[model samples]
Target: MRSTFDFSPLFRSSVGFDRMLNALEAANRMAPAENWPPYDIVKSGEDDYRIVMAVAGFSEKELTITHEQNMLIVTSEKADEDEKQYLHRGIPSQAFERRFELADYVKVTAAKLVDGLLTIDLKREIPEEMKPHRIEITDETAPRQGNMHQIEAEAAA
Candidate 1:
């Protein structure tokens, strides 16, 4: 039993959450998630992550990883093989494409394929301006000469 959601009320009261709201609507509209080509996302460090995908029969040349803005795309295409009779077919050969939405400042650092597993490494490189810095607390009697704006104000006076 699935229930629908109405976001009109949120739109009326919210100010700057358009992107989050759109993501929610997109998720609601998407089909049930597929389980093929199992993958795992692990947080290896404070700002590092890894994605490991089991691609049993895919080669390094057959896989492609792309990073665009805050999105990571992984696609695979199996090489064409001669028509051969087989007793049983269990492995999936059809092409597939998967997308992962990454957070701001997150970037793909490296990717490798080994033992039928595709591993991707990611790191978050926050800009200096975005990082927090300590601001010294000064006593009321302390001179405010350290501020350039204050110096300029005094020069104007």
Candidate 2:
């Protein structure tokens, strides 16, 4: 009987911020809250992302979008009715709650409900210091573009 160890790097780091690490680990281990509304995450551009949820039969008035901590939550609830009068209700028009994890600098740009889909745009604002930068090379150490020796040899030939 042999025992296996996790041996993950997360345990080897300094214990200064162990509480945050534990919270992150717990968040990652936990499954999604609910799957009541089908959604898609699409990368619109380099620093832009869009989350589209298929909320067919849900009205814009019933839906709510809110941000808590680093998570974006979208919840919806239908209006109360005295009597149910639906012969065939194929569309999913029930209460739903959806959550999305947002990056450090990501912010909600806009949200719109068109037809039956609810689209929420997110923009990641990267600081100038964090963005990738190109190093400028001086003429002295720059790599030669062509084979000058071969050109000289061809000229001699």
Candidate 3:
């Protein structure tokens, strides 16, 4: 059985989180999850991450990785198979597409296919202006030189 959730209450209290909420809702509505092409996501460093997927029968040419804004899309379409009789087919060669929603400033750094494993590296590069910085607190009673002109103008009035 499938389950559903309501986010109306969250929308009423939260601001600037529409994208995150929508992503969550879309995830919930997605078709029953498929286990094909098993994958793993690992945090290698404080701001670095890696996504490793098992693409047994796929080659570099058959796989594609794309980043659009905050969405990362990975797709694979196997080439036409040759007419060869197979006693048993265990590995699947069907085309598949996978998507991941990245947080702000998260970017794909590199991708490599080694020994049937596709490893994609990601790094979160926050702009210097957006980084948090400490602000020095000053006494309220202290005279401020920066606003002396404004104070003088008001006094003159």
Candidate 4:
């Protein structure tokens, strides 16, 4: 049985969460995930992440990685099949495409194929102006004569 959820109430009360809600709906509507090419996502550091995909029969030349506006697209071009008839073929050489959604300020730094494994490294670099910073708080009650509160008190007198 397929399950569906309504997010109308959330939309009525929330702000700035449209993208997240759309992602959830899109994921629910997508087809069954393809498990042919196994992959792993690892969090290596506080702001660093790694994605490793197993592509046994694919070469570096046949694989492509693209970063387009918060989306990572990995595609494997279909190679010509040989005429050799195999009694039992197990390895997969079929063309496949995989996509990954990246958070804001997250970017792919490097990708390398080693020993039939494709590794992609990503890092999140928040802008200096956007990062959280310490804000100094001062005593409001005990203020200088030029302070707004003091001015207001004198004006009322």
Candidate 5:
């Protein structure tokens, strides 16, 4: 485990609870089950994402990707066959289980394995109400609009 600090000054802070910040901080603590298989995470778009893992010598049936309660779980296991024999075994047969903490609006969009890479895609949809709304301000209203009352009221509610 690693130690991280919260250096968020009170000046010019956000309005409500910082769930995304917490999620990002929590992400630093997440570690792979083992170092056997390396992986990569790529963001394709605002909501689209991809998680690619180097999975050599493992068939599609041997790998698994699942999402549970906003957490993405990946695991790979290969079975031993008596019919096959190997003169020298350089590749690893060990299994691995990795857990990734997904954001609030994030979801697994799709998953596919190709060319020894297990790719898992994700999507994030910001709720309609959660999206920012534009507030029109007139000359008169702009004079009295510098108060934090609205933010406080929203937090209280």
Candidate 6:
């Protein structure tokens, strides 16, 4: 049995969240999650993250990683070969594509394949203009002596 949710209320109240809500709804409607080519996301540092995927039987040449705006896509396709015959085939080598949504400023830094595991490193680089900074509050009621002198000099002139 499957359950459905009504987000009409959220849609009416929220603003500028259409993409996020659509992504969530699409995730809910997707087929039951597949276990093939399992992956894990880990937070390595304050602004660093790592996505490790088990890509057994896949080589570096067969895997591709791409970043388009806020979406990170990882795909792997193995070349078909009819020469190898296996009585028992348990490992999944079929073409698969996985997408990950990244937050603002999150960027892919590096990718490496080690021991049949593909590790993708990500770093969040917030621009200086976007970072939070303290704003100095000045007392407007009190006038500085320099300003008073300047005003007096201007009046005399």
Which candidate wins on TM-score? 3
* Candidate-wise lDDT, in order: 0.89, 0.81, 0.92, 0.90, 0.79, 0.91
**Alpha carbon RMSD to native, model 1:** 6.2
Clashing pairs in 3: none
Clashes of each: 0, 0, 0, 0, 0, 0
Q: Rank the models by lDDT, top first.
A: 3, 6, 4, 1, 2, 5
Of the pair 4 and 6, which is ahead by lDDT? 6
The local lDDT score (0 to 100) that residue 46 gets in candidate 4 is 100
Q: Write the per-residue lDDT of candidate 2 for residues 31-115, one digit (tens) a residue.
A: 6566768889999999999999999888898999998766899999898866888899787777878878776678998999998
* Model 6 CA deviation exceeding 4 Å by range: 11-19, 138-140, 144-157
C-alpha RMSD of each candidate structure in angstroms? 6.2, 10.5, 5.0, 5.5, 11.8, 3.4
Q: How much is 66 displaced in model 4, in angstroms?
A: 0.4
Q: Report how far residue 152 has shifted in candidate 6, in Å.
A: 4.6
Query: Quick one: how many clashes does candidate 4 have?
Result: 0
Q: TM-scores, in order shown?
A: 0.80, 0.66, 0.85, 0.84, 0.66, 0.81
Which of 2 and 6 is ahead in lDDT? 6
Q: Candidate 3: misplaced stretches above 4 Å?
A: 136-141, 146-157
- Give a tens-digit lDDT track for model 1, residues 69-156: 9899999988999999989999887788988988889999999998888999999999999899999887878667766363344556
After superposition, candidate 4 runs with Cα above 4 Å error? 135-157
lDDT of 6 by residue, 1-157 (tens): 9898887788999998998888888878899866778999999999999999999999999999999998999998799878987999898889999988988899999999999999999999999999999998888898866677543445565
How does candidate 6 score on lDDT? 0.91
lDDT of 5: 0.79
Once model 1 is optimally superposed onto the true structure by TM-score, how far is the C-alpha of residue 14 displaced, in angstroms? 4.9
